[model samples]
Target: MKKTTINYLHVGYWLLVLVQTLLVSLGTGVLGTTFDWRLFSQIVLPVKFLQVLSSAIFFYINYLFLIPVFLKKGNVIKYLPSLIATLLIFTPLYYFLEQRLYPMIGWKSYDADLNFWFAVMITLSSNFINIFLAILLSYLMDWRTMRIQKEIIEKEQFKTELAFLKSQVNPHYLFNTINDIYALTQQQSAEAPNALLKLSELLRYMLRESDDQFVPLSKEIIYLENVIELQKIGQKGLSFVNFEVVGEVNKLKIAPLILINFVENAFKHGTFNKKNNPINILIIIHEQLLHFQISNQINHVKKDKTGGIGLVNVKRRLSLIYPEKHELTIHQLENEFIVDLKIALYD
Candidate 1:
């Protein structure tokens, strides 16, 4: 995951390998009964040094060269033949060097009683196990790298999709609000100038602030208030909009433009020619929980496809950003449409 952590793991693994190698080499009576510093320095150390060097060479050949070139490419045909040829060439050369070097170090031959072919076979078998372990370790490292890469790609894709969803909200909302402003201008109402100012502020919020992954809850509330004001200007008669905030929204942050979708949907489908139809929106924060609810009397008979698309986009955004931390529920009663949403803000 982190470079320092990976370095530590590599250090630990090599230390373990070194300890195992030391135990294998020193466990035998090659150094004799008493521990002699001169004997260790002169003979035993040299023999062990040679052994480690040979093993390291073989190990790296498989780890660095063979595994990446052949095994990673899935070229079993070439991989097997290459391994066999390496063993064939290395076995005799290793045996010949050991034969010449052992006597000089006062090293007794364990394979002296055995035939040459048997000794060669034994060396080949041991070297094969070493190479196999090296290859296995290489595979494990490659797999870890691939898994980390996959997670990074998935996270980037999720952010891209969420941005796309957020972008959709701005254009759709601007279209509706512009229509409301146009209606007011046609009527030549005194509220048209105020509505245009509110529209500009709302546009500034959407264009500038909504680009962030999260925004202040207070700011979002102000945007909603502007939307409600714009909607009120276009409609006449008794006021049927009710918005209430029930907690101290000091440092709270939420996904930008998330709460506005439900309010827009309510206003689009809830209003009627009669003054009886009303839209109610409520927001409350208690501890780490943020709760939002919206309900409106449904006056329209047929459902618009655009509203459905907006809802789908919001749902997708919520799932991507909050996942298990948020719950959203929509209900349609006899004459009312309701949305209840709860979000865990701490995480």
Candidate 2:
């Protein structure tokens, strides 16, 4: 609970205590009996206020100190005895104060009504109420605090796992890309520097940006574009990789690396040079929804795996991050494998 809310509860609780004290002191008999203004003002009202104040003291002492310091550690030895001692000490303090305050404040004291043992029993019972309330509210607060902490820890652990899943990659992609870069350098190809730059940006994003829970949708699209560009570079620019985007991708954020694994799989195991069955990648955004679809013709022989994510892990990530806000479907035919993913984006 919030601090302000807790403070409000405390205020309301003390107000009820005040009301309870009034009800207990000035009972229905006060309405029935002859009005004794002196008794109500001097004897009953002042002593009742003192009783309420003492109850407040006992509540705070137990709630803030005794419960946390001793009972929280299950130290009954210190906790129980300390509680009894506190009760004994404060139970009679009221009568003692009353005796003194009556004389000093020049308030009329009804000596017969102020019996010592009677006052102690009353104080003891009220103190027990404080004890019960203190123990109950203290533990209730502790439970709420622990639940909040557990949720925070779980969210952090979830992010750590998601980032680990995103970072997993097959080494062959780097090897092939590096080889492509070397070949380009040897042949004096113009795309070599841009390919290297794209590789640098991809790595930078994978290492740094992907660690964030969400990245700009625009940045993710650029990352996807870079991946396609670099993969084409490795195939000597002859790979028929068709990429398209539609609608607004700006002012929106998505979970990082969410779409990359499927695209990489399409490039890894799909036909590259066939014009009739080329790889198809599309991204569409409308009204805070993103639609990502990718499909490719089976090459008969599986190509090298690139960036890594099994379907199981990707599904788990989507469930963890987006849950009911996302939908995913996969389709496999004799010659083609297709993946369709849609997500509710955040702006």
Candidate 3:
């Protein structure tokens, strides 16, 4: 409980008990004296104060020690006995301090003589109320604590999944680059050194930024440029390329490796030039949106090399990360293929 709430509840409870005691005292006025402020301030105040203090102390001890011990031992039935013991321990301490000790200290007693049965009944009722409230409070505390634990576990699981996904991107990109290098080496061309250097630069990016989930848009563009340069080395004079970046390059950030796959797919499947259509790519940032377009010519009838799987993976990732925040389009017009993508940027 918040300290303020506990304090209010503590005071409110005792005030209720004091009012009950006053009513009882007033109801018995016919047998003795009537309700008087002088008597209350001098006698009733001292008794009420002692009763509240003793009750509070006993309640604290019972909840802090007795209840936990009972729960730990799985002794639900022992709660009644524990409550009885707590009352037995506190009642005398309060009665003795108010009636006996205060008398010695020159404080008048708000004393009443009743049949033993009535006192016993009052004590039993008080014990019942205490036990009921304590159980309810403890259950609320346990429930709130358990809810917080569940939230922590869910957050941790999400972090683990994100880390796994991030790790997967690095190796997947590296494997594709390695395959490119192998193809170039098999040809035994003069461009092999340049290809190796490009591979080294790509490896450097993977090592330095692999652990990062997000990178500057400019860094990704530079990496894509390196890949394109490396691909050009093997193409010799046979390949024609048209690359354009429109608009100013400002402080924009995006998920790493998101655009690379489209670039890679274009180069892998659309290299032939029968229709005079070479690889064309456009990447621009305008009004806080990343606009990308890539198209290449497909001359021969390839056997659905994509198999409708790789792009599916990208779509799944976009849904998981961006949901309704992105747009993508694909078209295959005779010998020409095209992909268009647009994503919002934060900066």
Candidate 4:
């Protein structure tokens, strides 16, 4: 809620309390007598006004000072003693204004009709209710404020994690692409110029379009196609790479750079030994869900321990952004490594 709205609500609440206090004081009469203008102006208004003033004082004391200082800090020992002392001090003050001050203003005091101990107990009981209500209100407001702050902190953390994951992905992809371009240049292949052009387009997409939290599925697919084209430029004539998109991808949206890591990993490990087996990639979108599968022949002897950072970073990003909305499975067989990922987009 807006701060101004909260402030208006607070003002409304105090106005309501003031109105109710005025009605009770002006109607029925506190001294158990019929409504009389003279008595009201002389006795009831002054007496009830003083009582309401005392209630407001005690309420604010508990709400603004005592609750935050002692009760909120879990210092019950000090809280109880301080509360009792405040009530004891204020109860007598309320009694004096209602009893002793009446006679000084040329009106009969009610003290002669009631026992001293009974009056003191009655005053304390009434003040206790006001103070307790104030404490409860303070606690509820504090809890609400804490809850809002916690949500804000969690949102900031999520953004930071996403940025860190994207940073890792950018460097990893650029490093591998540069190596590919360098290899072509060393061989003095004519494909070097064309490969550099594809690299420029890929870099433009990464820098401009992929900055959003979610991008159109079509754009992601195009990016994957570009990556495959770039990777294929340096491959041998007998190497095989196939990419297929199976359902509609018109308006579907997904996290940027999520699927490329798996494709990168496939090419990195699948062709390490120059095997003739094909690397397969399939993406299907149906019923507001996306299913992606990739499989490749593994060269276990050429595996590097630190080369799995792309996969690790993608997994962490998936967990943070999608949480229970996505599922991932990996399988390693004697000759092939496979990955299956499913994500629900309706939510």
Badly placed stretches (over 4 Å) of model 1 are 2-12, 26-46, 71-75, 101-119, 179-197, 234-239, 272-277, 301-306
> Highest lDDT among the candidates is held by which one?
2
Model 2 whole-model lDDT (C-alpha atoms):
0.81
What TM-score quantifies how close candidate 1 is to the native fold? Answer: 0.80
What Cα-based lDDT does every candidate model obtain?
Answer: 0.79, 0.81, 0.69, 0.80
**Reference-based TM-score, model 2:** 0.82
- In the range 27-128, model 2's lDDT, one tens digit per residue, is 756424676778677766776677678789988988899889999998989999989878777756867765667556555334565677776776687787
How much does each candidate deviate from the true structure in C-alpha RMSD?
Answer: 3.7, 4.0, 6.9, 4.8
Candidate 4: segments with Cα more than 4 A from true spot: 1-6, 15-54, 73-123, 170-173, 182-193, 236-239, 272-276, 305-307
- Candidate 1 per-residue lDDT, tens place, 226-308, comes to 98887777665344788899987877888889988888888777764355567888999987689999998886675575566
Q: Flag clash pairs in model 4.
A: none
Q: Which window of ten consecutive residues has the lowest lDDT sum in model 1?
A: 107-116
Which portions of model 2 miss their true places by more than 4 Å? 2-50, 65-84, 106-113, 169-171, 303-309
Better of 2 and 3 by lDDT: 2
Query: 1 or 3: which has the higher lDDT?
Result: 1
Q: Candidate 3: lDDT of 50?
A: 67
| Cα-based TM-score, every candidate | 0.80, 0.82, 0.64, 0.74
